[model samples]
Target chain A: MAAAEAAFELPPPTAEEEQWRYGPINDFEIESYEPSVASPGPIQVPTEGPSGAAALEAASAVVTVADGWVVNIEVSADAAALGLTIQAGLNEPRTGFGEDADRFDRLHEAFAPPTLCISMRDGAELETPVVIRSHHTGQGRACFPHAVVETGEDAGLDVVEYQTSTSGKGFAAPVVQLSAGAASRLRYVVVQELGEGIVQLGRILCNVGSQATATAAMAAFGGSYARVRTDTRLVGRGATGNLIAIYYADQNQVHDFRTYQHHDAPDTQSDLMFKGAADDNAGSIYTGLIHIHPDGRGSNAHQTNRNIKLSDAAWAWSVPNLEIENNEVRCSHASTVSPIDLDQQFYLHSRGVPPAVADRLIVSGFFGEVVDRFPGVGIQDEIRRLVAEKLDRRGANQ
Target chain B: MTELVITDLSVSVGGNEILRGVSLTVRSGEVHALMGPNGSGKSTLSHVLLGKPGYEVTGGSVSLDGVDVLTMPTWERAKAGLFLGMQYPTEVPGVSLLDMLGASFAASGIDASGLSDRLSEEAERIGFGQKFLSRPLNVDLSGGEMKRNETLQLGVLKPKIAILDELDSGLDVDALRLVSRRVEAATEEDGLGVLVITHYNRLLTELHPDRVHVLADGRIVAEGGAEMAEKLEETGYAEYASAKPAATAESRFASGGFDA
Candidate 1:
């Protein structure tokens, strides 16, 4: 988008729409926000992968983007030996993933930069993951960046995209398009820790091939009102799609998540688990669905959403829906929104564990089940430390 | 003055009087067996001492050598050397046994440098494998194992006074033998005061308690040596109810006893 193209665009979504319910849809105005003015820097080639603050040591490659512009890309010799390629362009939609579904996609199409593409050869099993960092800077400037990822048959890949804002007031919209080849395995993690004065809107379009596996995990703990929409499709028989997330909203912050799992082939499987905590006067909204078509006979799908309200004024809304056209498919969904358990409190206090410490333990422990199921990308300790800090701050305020 | 004293302790839970004018005391290193039937206020007395929520101490005074237990929070009272071994411990899903014990020690202001070694020694004394400490607290354990775990925590904490609520209910003969040996050693070596609450005479026989009291109608109805426990075992608490009238209302709801 170096040459700004002038064109007609669709209107942004409003809270009155069912798809944007429980979020700050009325506050999103694309017309008022200015474009990013980030200046490009000299690229630095390296023998080793990225290493610094908040950078993973085990990454095979690193890509850095600031204010919607690509700054640098580094790939190690090991990654090069494994036939990995990284490029930049716009990616056409894969099979069964539509492009004209939502207003956010329209916004991404109108303004998002040329997407970065990362691909791996068949049977390549690199142990270290590929790391991507997206940073936002300046006030009143919006950043829109996108990525496209694909893997060959029997290949394996792990990628993590972490988003943070240095010190600014702005809007960020990011999109990720991923497709796993037959019998391939992939895991993707996204973390958001932006500063106070940012509104983030993100989307993911994922597809799993025959006998392949794809897992995506997200952690959100920042921004004034952060919203994410994810869509997963099991397009081939015996394919699996797993979606999980852990998030927190403190003070008056709001976090919204929407997910859709589509089972289009016979004998496919999909599962979703999302957990979060809301503190102070914060709010969280979660709505998900598992859709099984006629050809998805003998498929299995499940979804669960659990939220904890850390304060009396905090609130959460959870709704899980299912649409199945095949009777042979097995599907289930469950959701719960509650305060901390009183029996749990008494049990800890009677053993001389203080109430504040006990709350922190319980909140972290609430996400342990999910963390255990999806192993390998190490962020468990970081999750615990962040949750502890949030609980400590809440306790100090009271 | 050297005793852990409970003077005219009257307590209620959800506005229902559970303990009325209950008074008791035990000197250091003494093993006292408090015998009462189900719902006879034995558990309520334990909960009030440990400051469990919903147990309102309307009129009572619990003190340890002039330190007012009723006025302090639960953790402070624990740091003041009061420990309660619950009958049914709740399951904390992701908090491991090692983490829980470490937090408890930290809260009680105990020296934690040698905790790992002490944990192993305590597990050995209680006949529980040290591997139990790595698992989540009280999750997926046998009934006897849970009981042994509670006794193990009691040994690890090493409080000056311990109140065991039905410690022998779920334990078999072998486990009971192990716990009794640990408790006896605690009382003899550490000058620990023991208050064992149970309805059965088998545990009292094992510990050979120094004093036995029968609680009925929200008050102690009879007190004697170990023979009183055997007699009550044979004839039950009904035989001692007629010896004294129930506690009076004025003493039950007396205001100034709370020391607030």
Candidate 2:
């Protein structure tokens, strides 16, 4: 009970905070929501291969969130061999919970019966990526998931998170924090494909230590209203970060994204590129900022956002901001929003390329810039196939 | 016989008349020269024949072997063996010249296999290098290169009727000779009907058209055999321009007769 009381204390939000400036806290109109009881459900662990159910068996940890509750938890022997610990349900069983439990804490207290926590020992490297899957299946319910990843000095880790749904009208609020120790490297990727009636708010925070590097790739394809926020802070000199995102929206859906690149120490570098395409009355909004502190000298940052509007009614808004307070810094940002050229269309059409086929080719070429930047050739091929499938579906529907 | 017959054609832009009662005929296996001063509606007539937007065909008919050409869409006209070698072709960035030619052939119902070989052979006939095949269509190309590129399209497309709009505008002597040779080859090999629109007799000297018509004040002021071109070269267009008043006459001097 004392532990629950200690962890449930709410922190006041400051008006001067930049992150909460446009937040919709007043819409919720709640001082706090009481934490619900944590009820564990049936755990279904598939024994198939990674291509099927068997791949989950090789994951360092697997956590499932169903019907606004964490129903299953699995940690593989490989993770145990690395001396990792799993933490979940930090507050209490029931009575000790209070109204001060915020949305994330409420989810942590109510639904998260077991939270998958992974830590790497010094000089240890995990060969397989840790998989965390959150499945929502309920009407008018919301789920909150929190993940904390930490790596010891000189350790390496890879994590892949998948957020999806079986069927339902619900919201998923997922928060992730990654801390990389000195000389450690981490590669993280998140794939979000929720239902059309679902609203998702995903936030990821990363802290990089000296000589460490981090790479994060995000792919968003489904949701009624989806917003992904990534905040990366380079806390040590000579640390590097790379962030890449690609999104496709169709129908009456809307996708919003906010990214921040913070350089807190000298000799830090970051590069970010986001590409998006909207069709069939869909819209997208992207806002990115690169911040360099006064003492953060010798920093390099570049950010680019490119969008394509397939239909006349579809629209996209991009805003890139750069705040540099130190000398010897290199920073640049560029954005473009325009319709496809009619001359290009006519040229392609003149060659007997049908209108739809021409449009698909142009869209594919439009998003190819980001896809080509992917590190692995296999990943690039897979992304290309996924993009082609989405384009085919959109073309067929039209 | 494949022929393009333009009779008493009048076209207007922004409600202002540019071509008034112009008449001419281009027969198969023969070349006809349309010589006129600047702003005399030579290029305007070509554009109107291609059915470009905003150019109103207020009067007259343009027909290809008895089919109405002005009523058809631009691409349909192009597919129906009517080609316009634009004086100033619009540059389309990111589109390769080879690809555009291949697509044009496919759109015109021509098979696409061996298309690159065909384009290359035609390009070689005109002394164009193979490196030119990879460049974007008309983007960053010189005026002479643009003309040759258009002629290359002419060779590959092999249109029955080609309207060469001022093909000799900015070419040097070497380029002019090259273009004239290609036109001569097209006429003999394909039995193609050609309408070479120009302002000078230099291109006509090498082209040697079957008939020459002097266009002035939006109408044909005089028509004669190839010697009419020589007369214009010797006398310039001063006499022809002065003799025409404000009269809107659609006159045709057939063989050796003049009604007026």
Candidate 3:
């Protein structure tokens, strides 16, 4: 599909496209919603908000963006001494994403309030993480929020981004761009908990430099139809990238994920692990690719996607693909979409665990493999709580 | 004292009878060893007692203190003080052994407070590391480690009766000793009833049984005291096999018994 002359004029993505297949694109309408043009006034922390600020007690900086507008920003003294800066708008020109840019990306580029930029100085190793809370609210409104995270050479940085909502129905397209410099260490975590009536199309593009390590973890447990596309490129020698995600959808919800691990340089490595579960009448789709370019000799990449269906009506699709153009590289991909293992259940039952409790434990253990690999302390606990909540909800419904 | 009674319990798989007419009685604080050759119906008896799926109960009644247990589910049977030490414990990834034991205790109406400390103490007594308690249950464990893990649960749960199936299959000399000692300690402490099932008498040497029963072709062909086990150790099950009856449909079906 070609880019529209104007971002607002771009048409909605159709289901015919491979990237949008198995998604709820046909139900989307870009023209029915109005863009968020004016700010929503002074910022006040909403106590009832999902993934609220109270969870992050040791954050070095806290920034809240509501309705695609930056409402508040706070930085600690320690963060300032470490040469960390948070700007409201982009510092440089925003070049359009070339050919692969879709209608949603263009729409975000044209109407997004401002690009929030987080920069870490060289050799700076900040002990505390920076928390960014992106909230979308208002009915029949569309919002685009973008953030760029850049780290200087040999720097160490940690960040947690929370995407949440207040209103019952809305549309949001949030984009985050991450660049890890040479020998730097970067960890970025995103938690999405939008309302059930909301629709979200989010993206995260990360580039890893020579000898740098970048890990990106996302936990999605919200939205009526939430889809996130991630692209991680290893552009320098010996770079490593880890992509992890855990999602749960229940009661007419649909969670979709697409990932790309591109090994473009020699000896680079990337590993992707995605796990999800669907209960009630919900559904989930996971499609990922591990692409090794010709110059990616000696590169090693692996992709794994696993899902569990908790009910006969619940559905899940897992498709993992690998494209290797280098003969010297080693690559593998694995995917599974099945119900819980009976043997595992029997093991629990034989130990005197009741059936209902056994199901919850098995599902929690299913997602535990990915949750334990995540980096943030507060966010990991929140993810566990949210998973348990989902399980409890299922138990109540049944 | 609690007692488990199995009267004329007959089991079949795929329309072929395995245990034609088996009967046994095990009381608390007593240990009975069930010995049989490879083709005999030893493991099948333990599995049927535990209510493992796919084994049909053709005719029989199993009662734990006057409660008919054949109609109960697997977990219900466990909660009713029935335990089966599996030959091959299933690997449950991401679920810690501590969590499993705690949950089991909770389901069985036992207080779960201080479970971690209790597990740690048991680990110390058995020479097992505390780290194993925090690790996933049976995940990535060696065969010997899996057997020892089962023994740990057997000690912790302290069921009224435990049918240990092939408890010595994968243990080294030291591990077998450690595991058997743990079982003996549990019996002494809790007055636990036990039915030890094995193809060899090596395990029985460490954990002595009050009585021994030899099962040949799904029938109790011989029964005696510790002397019987000593005699079998010298002559083996070859004499019993020679005296075994001709191959009936059930015996032929027993040839291809459930191995896993």
Query: How high is the TM-score of chain A in each model?
Result: 0.92, 0.81, 0.96
lDDT of 3 by residue, A173-266 (tens): 8888889999999899998888887899888899999999999999999999999999999999999999999999999999999999999999
Docking class of 3: medium
lDDT string for model 1 (B1-260, tens) is: 25789988888888878787788888789999999777778998988888887888878798988788998878777767788888888788788767777888887677778888888889998889878877787888877788888888888787889999998988999889999889989898888899999989999878879998888757776778999889888898776554452344555444332211
Highest lDDT among the candidates is held by which one? 3
Each candidate structure's TM-score, on Cα atoms with residue i matched to residue i, is 0.91, 0.67, 0.93
For every candidate, give the share of true A-B contacts it also has: 0.62, 0.13, 0.65
Rank by lDDT, highest first: 3, 1, 2
lDDT of 3 by residue, B156-188 (tens): 777889999889988998888888888887778
For model 1, how does the per-residue alpha-carbon lDDT over A1-398 read when each residue is reduced to its tens digit?
A: 42233222445678888788888779777667786644345433222211123446778888887777667788899997997877765453322236455555655566666668888899997788888877777478888777887889999998887677755688888788788999999888886777778888888889899999998888888898898899999999999999989889999899999999999999999999999999999999999989998999999999999999998999999999999999998999999999998877777776778887777777777877776765463555555555666777888986
| Candidate that scores best on DockQ | 3
Q: CA lDDT, every prediction? A: 0.80, 0.73, 0.85
Model 3 quality (TM-score): 0.93
Candidate 1 Cα deviation (angstroms), residue B77 = 1.0
* Clashes within 3 Å, all models in order: 0, 6, 0
Q: Can you tell me the CAPRI class of model 2?
A: incorrect
lDDT of each residue in A1-398, candidate 2, tens digit only? 55445444544433244543333323332223333234436544222221124435456777665544566667777777885555564432232223643444444444443444556777788776666666665355666566667788888887766666645667666667777888888777776667786777677778888888887888777887777778888999988888888888888777778898999999998999999988888988888899998878999999999888888898888889999999889999999877875655644543334566656666766676687665444445546666777798888998
